[model samples]
Target: MILYGGNVVKKAALWYILIICLRVSAKNGVTQDQVSSRTNTLFDDVDDTQKQLDNEVRERLAQPKTVWVIHIPTRFPVLQLEDLSVTEPTFINTALVRSRREYQLGNPELEDPIISNNTTPCENVEEESSSEEGNVCDSDRTESEKPSEPEKCEEQEEKPGDDWTFDTQHKWHENFPDCAGQSQSPVDLPIAGLIKTRGARKLLFVNYNEIPNNLTLIYNGRNVILTGNWPRDRTPAVYGGAAHSRRYLFHSLVVYWPSEHTIATLHYPMETQALHVSAEYGSFEEAVANSPKDPLAFLGVVNIYKFDSETQAGLRTIINSAQKCKKWSVSMKPMPLSVFSPPFKEYVCYQGSLPIPPCTESVLWMIRRRSLTVNRESSLAFHSMLLGDDPPQKVFIRVAQALNDRHIYFFR
Candidate 1:
């Protein structure tokens, strides 16, 4: 019994020592409360430091890199959707060149810099800087702040127009040598056929007419239905619209084919005022061409009165099928073609003077033809200009020329 009691007491002592050892091993000479408090303080400090670091990063990013920008003088600066890229940031750099010498961005030897912060006339600078000041400026300006009715007053005030000529220090043309004396017109042009020409050139229209021909003993395996007539003297057949020097004559003919394969011609630029006639029959083979600089080179099918993909696809499929067919008839109209429905294709009658310098008589016009089926809804949402809802409208076709009693032709 005594031995059993001794063993019990020894076990209890060993257990108490183990408990003390465990407690000592768990902490570095600190109480549980003290350790917890210190840990909380360290965590709070880390959190506050992290927040401050995050704020600093944000502030640095928010700051704008200020640079002085100038506009270089140009006769016509055409702005197109192609000029802007969603993936690219536009940073335009302007340089000032003089007859004496060309100066770049930095040259520190001079006392007064070329562009000073005070002289840099960026209109939005003040607003942006004030915004950067943030809540501090808001608090300071509280007493001085006045409720602004900008929306009400905006309509009444006349905003300054964006003048292209503004801040132009030295006009290049004014100082440069005049080349007007070197300009002269050519009497007769060299004829070209069956060869391609290169370099920048202008095409002035001479004449355009459609002449019908039957599917004769086939030429080059394809049925040649219409032959375009370019007069011997590639000038306008009839000049004026009146009897004395006004009334003009034009050849207008309709082509008939079996109902299967319809024919339609697409005039590109849709706005070419003048016809550039090459001595050659085909445009592609003509060496001296008068078409658009970069004419849409790809082949696309055109219906008489509308732009139909199904009809195009059907025709393409038929052509691919290699079937020997005898009969097909296609229809065409005299005036503007009419083969489209509402919304998808709209027809608006416009009466405007001819785009040419002479300003010929107005004609009845119908424009909408193609019902372009977009692949996705996101494709249509490109209207946002990085500003607001006022998306710009694109002009697919040029303004129609004034019809001066001229009969236009089509394939039926």
Candidate 2:
């Protein structure tokens, strides 16, 4: 029996009905072979009838001065009617019937027909529509497919010399060979070694008594930096103890949290670095280029978060200023340099390199032994600010490097 269907759902339902009939016949004592034979015969009869119709259509289409019109339904509204012509009537008829069947079955492969010519057969119209639809469907499927495992891994892999982050420590040596050197910064300070050291000179701070009134809070990719608006001649300088008679000019200050390195098995909740360059160099870039060996000094101060209901006045100002500036943005405000400075002066001296990349060695590191107190409210505020806009990694701290026979001196 032949079934006529207008939609794909109907055709699918018809197929299910045929399968049910076959199962019923088998249950009614019909042999399996006989039931299979009957099913094949029914399909063969339908195929023959379809072939005959196609042949007849083809023969008629071959006649001269003949115009065939066909109707096609699409998901969208039928905008206009079109006439399509084909030389082989049988092929055109078969294609049209196949397309109509597939569309009714809810096949995503069917394309909308373009019916411009009223004289063309419906089969020809369907063939044109299917061609366009196939291209679009295939292209979309290809693009939407999930990427392979290897492709995802490649995207996540860190490359050498890319922006430095805490997780990218393995790639640091590849980018800057100096990172693997012996005198790298942030070395673990054993409490026994620091206390046992003798002949350590006291550190002297020059012009650090007054805080610079004009300063800006800049959110670099890694940390929040405080840049001062002090002239080259008027910039604060520090010497004494391990600072070998050479005055280090204070440049910028960076604030960090969750101490990058351990000291006497203790980890501070926050840390800050006051970066200074050699006074001999005119600019920071010049100092880095000319004195590649050891031209910078870092005064490190660690801080512990205390449970205080009120936030520190200086820290509250920084948090407020950061809220006005977007991530990775810099905004100038009337901030004081003393706000970010350490409260205590007693420190431990050591020789190390820049903790960050290009990892230049020969830096005089003066880490304060006493921990500064930051209010719990302000500490939470610091964590709220993001490092940069769309940063690859959210972590701001770098991993501590090896000590490699370096001595830690305590200067009171």
Candidate 3:
């Protein structure tokens, strides 16, 4: 029978009832009805093999896989440089010098004689220079001394995130290769954010939004100067749009580190006989160290490094090391489609860009086998931290866009 057909549960319940009644009739003195008569008429022609085939198809119908199609850009513009290395001028130097000039004019207190050429006369100098030659010295230098060109700062090139946007002509298709025509952004490059593959496993991506970006917290006594306001979009938050801010979900990533396995076993929840997160009777590392060698079951504790603004570049610089390792993997437990579904009850389908930029149209939308729970209290606490109470609470994430004709991959 088709798995989604109406009354399937009712039919299943009725069959159970019939079996119970048949047993009771046999125990009592009543002449029992034939098994076929009690349990809705059985098909004489359908054999065990045919029944098994139907069951297999029904199981397949219930779950589907998910795919992420990435798009790339074409024709990047060449950034102009003010200074170059190899004893040449480069763009970074030009930008830095310009930045220094603007900053000096904007903050008078920070202006130093070394930077401004001591042009701002001291009140005491006026008392001494009150004589004729002093007056001549001030007047002659006023016009003759060329305005000390704003002291040029040793220029450094601004990084990509601070100044670049993706090209517009390229677009993604639901299928492969078509999306491949569009080049991947620096962040989208498999090797850019994470390291390239080392041996056999895949490294997962992490976005640390909980840590604050305040410079004081990062640089307590450092000599380095920090620039630019940190972008809020990078932090997971409900941006106002088609989806209410409240609807968004937050996820964290962890690195995979494995240990030697000692036993062979099937993974399961102790009571339900289903796949669920296991409690660490011992520490998580101890569990991993002792558990059998199922690639999927190797769970261990990883130190979550705090990622704030000052530390971001240092981490990105070392990303290549993480990539050099043999294995890095992403978490792919099936999340409910309804959780990603739109707010309206009637609209069965729709589609849109990936919230992340280069917002490509490569999602093969599938909900979930089961809905994940988000209690009201937990959601509210999360939202209050991001949006603040200025506006009343609202659903935050975008509803699931349409699947189009794209094939969905279900991990069974």
Per-candidate TM-scores read 0.17, 0.54, 0.18
Tens-digit per-residue lDDT, 1-412, candidate 3: 5666658887889999999998897765344334445442245336656989999999999878889886531111121212111221232243543334221211123223112222322211112111222112222344433122212223233434222111222332322222332222111101011111112111111122223242110110101121212234433222111121211222222111010110011110100000111222223233334333311121111111111112111111112112111122211112211111111111001122222233333211111111112223323333343233334433222222233432211111
lDDT tens digits, residue span 1-412, model 2: 2334357678788999999998897775543344345334466668879999999999999989958887642111232322112122222244543334221101122232111111211112112111232112111335333111111101122335546766677788887898888888777655342332334344565655344556656664456776777755566777755565667777887677666655433444566687877677777667667645444434333333222234333444455556523434444544334444533344556677777888777577776543334455567667656533455456767766788887665544
RMSD of each: 33.5, 38.2, 32.0
lDDT of 1 by residue, 1-412 (tens): 9999999999999999999999886774353344454434466668879999999999999999989888741211211212111122143222222221122112223222222222222211122111222112112334334212112101122224212121231231243222111211100111111011122122111232222121111111112121123344432222211111221222221111111111111211111011222222344223213222312111111222111112221111112222222222222111101101111111111222211111222211222222111111111221121113222342212222223332211100
Deviation from native of the Cα of residue 281 in model 3, angstroms: 36
State each model's CA lDDT, in order.
0.23, 0.53, 0.23
Ten residues in a row with the worst lDDT in model 1? 185-194
Q: How do all the candidates rank in terms of TM-score, highest first?
A: 2, 3, 1
Query: Residue 208 in candidate 3 has what lDDT?
Result: 21
Taking all chains together, the TM-score of candidate 3 against the true structure is 0.18
Q: Mind sharing the TM-score for model 2?
A: 0.54
Better candidate number, 1 or 2, judged by TM-score: 2
lDDT of 3: 0.23
Off by over 4 Å in 2: 1-162, 195-201, 210-213, 295-313, 324-326, 387-393
